[model samples]
Target: MSNSQQQYPFYFKSTIILFGISLVCYALFVLSDILAPIAFSLVIAILLNPMVTKLQKRGVNKIVAISLAIGLAFLIVAGIIYFITNQIVNFGDNLPQLKLKFNENLANVQQWLNTHLNITIAKQQKLANEALNSSQALLGRTVGGALGILSLIFLIPIYVFLLLYYKTLIINFFHEVFAEENSAKVSEVLGATKAAIQSYMVGLLLEALVVAVLNSVALMIIGLDYAILIGVIGALLNMLPYIGGIIAIALPVILASVTKDGYSTQLAVVISYIVIQFVDNNFLVPFLVSSRVKINAFFSVLVVLLGGALWGISGMFLSIPFVAILKIIFDRLPEMKPWGKLLGDEVPTRHKGEIWQRKRLRQEASNPEKEKSL
Candidate 1:
């Protein structure tokens, strides 16, 4: 019998792999509430690990060290929350005037439509009412989302504490799970994954802070209302990768359209945000977060959208880290190194099916170190 017929067929293996992936995606959506918090906690825990280790080396008890690290992280998060909510309170105080401005703008827009399109005033009023209702509904949803996020915040610290406390247990569990010869590989994967997640999260926070400052200054100079709040939000959203950047750009533009009188103000907002994004993409990301994870643009967008689809906002945030961990594991295994390369951004040789390129590919496949160097 031919090898294809005598052994498990490639199609059969492919089918199983496809099924496994679908099952995983479905499970992610189903168990998001349980998994998302844990995933987030793991990232925070990894970032805090070095501090905890330092304290441990200085003769602090593990629990004490972990607690101190978690406490510091909590304070940082709480400070950010306070900063945002303080702005939100100020925004609430201005609601009456903001609403008045919105109504005047809406009426002027309705009038313009009536004059330009020969639309009746009554029909325009109906459309305005519908829009107002939709806006209210959107506001309600936003409030709900905020509450959900606050709940997640409460759960995350507990998870981080537990993860940090059980750090050795987890390592021992891995050692027990993997075969004896693979112990070194397991440690390597763990160390690399921790470093990657830690760097990515810290770098992301630094990038966001810088971007927020720039955005706030630009918007303030443009004399936009609630400029600080909008700028901070845009910077935070920019952390979410592809889907987020669109939302970030759209939000400031929309705010400018409603509050600022002239089209020029809105145009300025657009131009400023575009320039800031240019700086962020070209300089800030490369300097800060890009090196650690290094997933290609295609997979970054794909996983982000998939994450949003499966686990909502938490999924979107967690996807890149999760992919990085996967790539680390894949790279550590000989059979899976190709899959790791698939997720990565590195493109050493571009042309397809060229003789030299094919030779390089074969060499890299045979020698994983060469592939990494390339």
Candidate 2:
């Protein structure tokens, strides 16, 4: 048998293995609707671990700490729900005015199109009517869909509470299952995983808060109606990464174009969103998240899109950290290190020559008597 023939079989096996892994990942994506809530709960549990630890240090029992953390989380969630509900109610009361303003803007757009092109007013009106009809159906579906989503929201806190309470038991079980020699390595990996998830969650929350406050204040200063609602939406969407900034800007611009008296206000809203995103990406995330999850831009975009495909908006929001965790595990395995390297931003430096040179120098530096003794 030739050497090349032997190598061909190895390459073919490796290809098969990769294909199998991809198939499994695709299946997981299809099932992500069921898994997303569980994933979200795990992320929350990691985020709250520090608080749980502090509470335990203060002599509180594990169950009590977990319960208290869950209670606080529920209260925070309730407050947000209360605020959003009030906003929706106020917006509902002003819907007629909003619709009128929207129609006025639509007229302006139609006028611009007529002036710029050879389109007839009748054709434009027909198009507008069709669009309005479609929008009504879409809005009805969206409202109905939201009720179903609200039902699922209750599951998150319960999942989080159970995860927190069982976290130690889970870790201990894993440690016991693994050989004693491998247990330390397993623990180290788990520790790193927890730290990465915690840092990501906290950093993201801080970024959202900063974006929300700055955006709301900027819009309020510009005298935009429903500035609070727009700001909150912007902050929430900003958690999704690259595409989120654009979505955040569009919402406010649409709102301004419809409700504001002038085009200048619409431009101002756009500029404010851009500035907030700039501050967030450049200044906020880097400092808050540290150098823990160093994913490259290409993979970042790919994972976010893949996540969006799998689980829609929630998947997109979770993709980066999810990929980061996978990368961490890949790096620890010898065969998967190359895949991990691909996911990382920085090119790892080759240390073979450096190590050889260092060893040579050390040998040269050693005394003759020491060398002879060795």
Candidate 3:
């Protein structure tokens, strides 16, 4: 058969691809406890690579440069942790007052429901008791989750150091696997992935800072207690794509309802968040985070939801970068370019024929003869 005329079995190929994807997903889910920390470490190591390179160019030893970069990153993280811990400590002091306000609101709600909806306070208490039981179980799971987080905190740094130290071996392994046939393409993909990730990570941090400031300022203007703390938290959660934004909004709204009298202040908080979200989605994301990663919003949200389903929050956070790396690789390979386009944000350009076709279709309502002839 001529090369151009060669035919492949579409169904078989698709089946194989589907099976491979399923197997990989299963493995990822099963080994998530082991893999998630490693994945995070690799991303952080990639982010720190430029610093290591710059230090090495200045005659710093490779090992020393890596150590210095890691140390600097550690100190910055520690400082942030300390600051947030202090905030939490201060926030704890208001718990009693918060509880009192919450109880008062709950009573008012019960009274309103009794008057308007004809629901009794006894029925509401029964429902609340059922919810409290479920919440207690949730609290236990949360405690276990905290311990897991602590373990990851200890493990990730070591993984990052090892990954950085063996970075040369990792690069060489890719070249060896691809061999000479596609060595150049592999190198290009690697470089592009690294640059995209580096820029995206740095830009993500900057964007989060801007969002935190905006949130804090809005809350402070409305005189919300613990505004700075809640704002910082919301900004951090907003890093996790679609779902985080919902949770971020809920926290302040709940606080507003509990602490403030009447619903006007709560309404203001919601309005403020809606405006901030509009600014964030339209302006901040395009300029900072989305500039490097070109995945379209539909797939971005889909992958995030899929990632969360498969590997929980770590997967949600990791999904975009993973998809971006895939896109870069896909676009380079001739057969995979279509797949790259599927994930990419680029809109398909309209040709003259398409526009002309639409114009004809619109005119066809008055031209039954022309439509029948066609």
Candidate 3 per-residue lDDT over residues 266-299, each given as its tens digit: 8988999999999998999888885465888899
lDDT of candidate 2 over 1-374, digit per residue (tens): 88766655788988999999899778766555457777888888888888998999999999999889888987897899899889989989999989998888878887888899978789998997998976564333222354325525777778898899888898999899989999878988898888888888888888888888998999999899888988998888887778777878998899888887768998887777788888888999899756476899899889888776666666777789889889888998899998898999986576668989988878868776777777
lDDT of each: 0.85, 0.82, 0.86
Estimate candidate 3's RMSD in Å: 5.5
- Model 3 residue 252 CA deviation (Å) reads 1.1
Q: Residue-wise lDDT of candidate 1 within 2-121, one digit each (tens)?
A: 876777879998999999999988887666666777787888888999999999999999999999999998889889999999999999998898788878887887789889999988
Candidate 3 lands at a TM-score of 0.83
TM-score of each: 0.83, 0.79, 0.83
- In model 2, the Cα lDDT at residue 202 comes to 82
Q: What TM-score quantifies how close candidate 1 is to the native fold?
A: 0.83
Candidate 1's C-alpha runs over 4 A off are 1-6, 103-153, 356-374
Q: Report the backbone clash tally of model 3.
A: 0
The order of the candidates by lDDT, greatest first, is 3, 1, 2
Residue pairs in collision within model 3: none
Model 3's alpha-carbon lDDT is: 0.86
| Each prediction's RMSD to truth | 6.8, 7.0, 5.5
